[model samples]
Target: MTAKRSKVAPRVATGGGALVPLPVGLSEKEAAQEAYRRLDRRVHARLGAAVGGVSVIGLAQAWGDWASHLALSPGKQMELVWKASRKWQRLAGALGRDPDSE
Candidate 1:
């Protein structure tokens, strides 16, 4: 009599990367903020001085509008503004403008 064969699963070769799942607890607003922050990083890296003027101004204004929807504390608001100001200064410096002038 033939021996019964055990069920076997197919195996794939190594070297391909696996997909990672995002954390389960992140909220929609937090996700959008993270996306915006990443996009800003890419923009600053690629555009440099060209982003210092109108685009940055528009970004600040957009932040103001979006921020109003969140119930952030005064301290948190200040922290966000402070971080934005630093980036603005860096951009201004790239453009050869006096950062203090803004």
Candidate 2:
């Protein structure tokens, strides 16, 4: 038995490269700087989400563990704090990238 294939022709333009955005009224240097700023903000947003997620998970896990034990678990709690601090440090590093420098 032979199978038939359907053909589609409307997905792409007939003759053109992918579109590139042109910055109106901005010099190339300014456009590059603006693009860098956008990229930096996007990175920061992603890093912020990661930091928040890790912080929440660490806190919830530690709280649940402590609730189950009901005694002092400073060691585990401190460990969670340390991990959260590390995540914050990662976010800080991401924030340290300068969009205007180079």
Each model's number of backbone clashes? Answer: 0, 0
- Give the per-residue lDDT of model 1 (tens digit) for 36-99: 6655765676676666545766888988977785555787878889999999998887899766
- Whole-model lDDT, model 1: 0.60
Whole-structure CA lDDT of model 2? 0.63
Checking candidate 2 for backbone clashes, the offending pairs are none
Q: Model 2, residue 65: displacement in angstroms?
A: 22
Deviation in Å, model 1, residue 41 alpha carbon: 37
Question: TM-scores across all candidates?
Answer: 0.27, 0.31
In order, what lDDT does every prediction score? 0.60, 0.63
lDDT of 2 by residue, 20-92 (tens): 4534555555556666776676666786687774665577799899687745777778888899999999999
